[model samples]
Target: MEIGKLPNDMLQNIILNKIKHFRNDILVRPGIGEDCCAIDFGEYSCVMSSDPITGASNEIGRLAVHVSCNDVATCGVEPLGLLVTILAPVYASEKEFDEIMGQICDTAASIGVDILGGHTEVTDAVNRFVITTTSVGKVLKDKLVVSSGANPGDDIIITKSAGIEGTAIIAHDREDFLLERLDAHDIERAKGFTGSLSVVKEGVIAGKLGASAMHDVTEGGILGAVWEVATASGLGAEIYRESIPVEDITQKICNIFDIDPLKLISSGCMLIACKNGNEMLKALEASGIKASRIGKMTEDKETFIISRGKKELVSQPGTDELYKAT
Candidate 1:
C-alpha cells in the first residue's frame, strides 16, 4: 500500500501467510529481516537474493548490483555471480540502454561478480526503466549466519554512518534542489556515499569471527533494521541514540527534508549481533571499516530507544522516510 516496503503486519498476514515451506534443504527461508534465502548443499550453502532498483533513477544500474549483492552479504556469504533482468520503457533510447548496461558491467566487474545470462526487453509495461538482479553466493555450512540467530545479551554493532545510501540517493537525485539550499561541497560529499555501499568485507569479517546475526540496513534504515533483528530473534533491544553514527552531510540533508536519519533507507550501513562487541569492533576497525556498538539484545520482547536520559518504544516501520523526501 505504501511506496517503499510493505508494512510488517500486512506482509506477514497477506504474503507470508500463504507461503509454504516445500523443501527441507532450505536453510534460511523468507522472513522479515531475512533478505536472502540459503539452500543447503551438504558441505556448503548457496545464498540467493533478488532486489529491484526503483528508488534512484540516476544510478539505477549501480544500485541494482550493490543492493542485490548486499542481500547475500547479509547472510555472511561471498557473492560470486548475478542474474539480471531489465524492463525498459518503449521510449527509452539506445544510448540510455547502453549506459545502463555499461554501469552494471563496470560495477559487477569491480566487485568480482560475473553477470550471468538474463532477459532484457522494451515494453509498454511502465514509464521508466526497471532493473532487478538475483545475486548468488556461497558460504561454508558452519559459517552461515541469519538474522534470527541473535541471542540475548549479544551486542548490536552498526557499521558505517546512518542513512548513507539514502543520503547519496537524495543528493544525486535532488542535486539541483540541494545545491540551492546547501553548500556544494556537502552535496558532493553526500553523493559520494554511493562508493561505500558494499559491506561484503565487513560482513565476511564479522561472520567469520563469530557474529550471531547480521542484517544489512536498507529501506528501513538503522532503527528499522534493529527492530527487525530483534523481532526475528524474538528478543528486544536497547538502542543508544547517542552511539548511532550519523554523518554531518546526512544530518543536514535529513534536516532539510524533515526526516529522521535513523528511519531513512540505508544500504551502506549494516547491523551486527555478536556476543563480544569489543571483538567485533576491533575486527571491523582493523579491516578499515568504521563500526560502533550502539545497543544490546535483551530477553524481553520490547524494543526501545534511549535518548536524553529517556527511553521510548520504537514503533513498527512503515514507508521509509526517504520516500517522503523524494
Candidate 2:
C-alpha cells in the first residue's frame, strides 16, 4: 500500500500534541501540511526532511540524497548538509557497501552538501540495501515557497515530464521486458533518466522568480502534486491532460507496461503554482527546463481534468504506478 499521511491516532496524538511541547521558534513556524519541518535559527531558519530509497535495487545511494533534497527544494532553499543512514541485509558484501557510499559521496559533492552524521548497520530487515537521507537547508521566510500559497486564478506549471522517476526505475528493474520490446540503444537512453531524479535547479529558479507555491512531483506524479497544492491552498484546479509533457522514453515504457503516466512517480518535474505563471514559465525555459502551464486554479473547490474535451473529476492517488511498473 502507498504510505498515506500519518493519522492523528492515540500514539501520534501524544507525541505531536501532548508530550512534545511545541515551541514557536523565531524562524520555525509550526504548520500543518508543510512537507518538512521548519526551524527558526534567528537570521535564517533551516528546513529539514528525511527520505529513503526503497523501490530500486540500483541507484539507491544517488536517489536517497536527491529525493530528500528535492523536498527542501520545494521550499526554494539550497541544501547545505545531509545525514545519511544505510541499512543492509546480512548477506551484503563490502563491495556493495563501498559502491553505495561512493554513489552518495559523488552525488552529495555535486550538490555541495556536507555529510554530517548517520548510522550504518547490517541486519535482516530485508534483502536489498536501504538508504535514508535527512537533508537540511536554510531560507528566509520571505524567500520560502510553500505549497499552501496557491491562490485562485494562479496558473499551475509542471517542469520536465511525467513518469520520469517511475519509468526509469521500472526500466532498470524489469530488464527482461524492456529488452524484448526495446532496442539496446533505447534501453540505455531510458536508463539515463536516473540523473533526472532531481529538481533542485528548477526549484531554485522558480523560487527566485517568486513562485506562489512549489512542489516536487514524486510518488504520485504531476496530478498528485497538483492536488496537494490545491488542497493546501484552499483552491481548486482545472487541468488539461494534453498539456502535460511526457518524454518519448516514458511514453514507450508506460505504453508497454499499460500504466497511466499521470499516476506514475515523477521526480524531475517541479509543480509550481504562481500568479504570473507565464513569466515563471519563461524563466524556467531560459534555465533550460521545459515548463508547461497545464492548468489554472479555480474557485469551484473541485479538482478536474479535461481530456478530449471531456472533464473528469479526480481524487487523491492510490496504488501509484511506480511500484507496479517495477
Candidate 3:
C-alpha cells in the first residue's frame, strides 16, 4: 500500500460502516467524496470537515485550525465556527499545551471563525500531541460547490503554486539544514507562506464569479486533488505542467528530495473548476492571488497531465504519494 488509498472493502468495513448509523434528522447532502460534508441545517446547508496535525509537529495549533477551516472554504463557504480536540501524551507539558491553544485561538480570531467546543484529554495511547479541529460553515442551497461539480468543457484553474504547504513544513522542520544552504531572505519568504493556508477570500470570490467546483489541495498535492475531483465527478481532465506556479525554493526542495512537485502536499492552493475560465482567472488575479488556467476538463474518462519540457505524464497513479513519502 505504498501509494494507494486503503482498499475500498477494508475502508467500508472498518471505517465507513461505523459512520453508517445515519438517522432521519441527519441527512447526508451531496454525499461522500466531496471535499466537505454537506448537511441540511434548515435554512442553509452546513459544510463540515476535520483533520489532525499528524505530519508536522511544529505549529500544530495554527496548522490544525487553518487546515480544518480550509476544507469548509473549499466548498465555497466561510468557516463560521470550529470544534477542536487535543490529545496530549502523558509527557506533554502545560506551558506547551497552553501555547498551542493560544495560537489556535489567535488564528481563529484572525479568520473571524469562532471556537465552539471540543474535548481535551491526556492519554498514553499517543506519543505526541495531536490536535484535531472540526469546522462548520454555511453554504446556500443554490451555491453549493462539490468536488463532483466539475463538468466537461470547464477550465481548470489553480491558485498559488504546487507544494507550498510541503515546502513550508520542510523549511520549518529542517531550519538548520536550509539555513546552511539558503540565505536568511529565502527562509523568511518560505516561512511567510504559512499565512497562505486558508483560501476563504479567494474561494468565496470564485464561487461568486462562477466556479463550478472548488477543492483545496492538501494531503495529496495538486495532482492528487485533481484526480480525486475527476474520479468523484466521473470525468477526465488535461492539465499543462508549464501553467502551474511553483516557487524557486519549492522547486529546489523537490529536486533535492526527488519528489514530484505536483505530488507533494499543497494546502495553500485551491483548484477551481471554472465555467468561464478567463473571468475566474481575472478575478483571482484582481484579488492578488496567482491563478492560471492550466487545463480543461474532458470527457475521455482518463486523466492526462503534461509537463513543461517533459513528454511523459506527471500525473499521479490515482493515489496519494504523501503517505508513502512520509
Q: What is the lDDT, from 0 to 100, of the residue 128 in candidate 3?
A: 91
| Model 3 poorest 10 in a row by lDDT | 316-325
Query: lDDT per residue, candidate 2, 178-266, as tens digits?
Result: 89988878778878898887888988888888888888887667777787778777878999999998888889888887888998878
Cα error of candidate 2 at position 139, Å:
0.9
Highest TM-score against the true fold, candidate: 1
Give me the runs in candidate 3 sitting further than 4 Å from their true place. 1-32, 308-326
Estimate, for each residue in 91-175, the C-alpha lDDT of model 1 and write its tens digit: 9999999999998999899889999968899999979999999999999999998989999999999999999999999999999
Q: Write the per-residue lDDT of candidate 3 for residues 117-173, one digit (tens) a residue.
A: 999999999999989999999977678777788899999999899988887777777
Error of 1 at 181 (Å): 0.4
- Report the error of model 3 at residue 226, Å: 0.6
Ranking by TM-score: 1, 2, 3
Error of 1 at 323 (Å): 1.1
- Give the residue spans of candidate 1 off by over 4 A: none
Please report, in order, the local distance difference test score of every candidate based on alpha carbons. 0.91, 0.82, 0.80
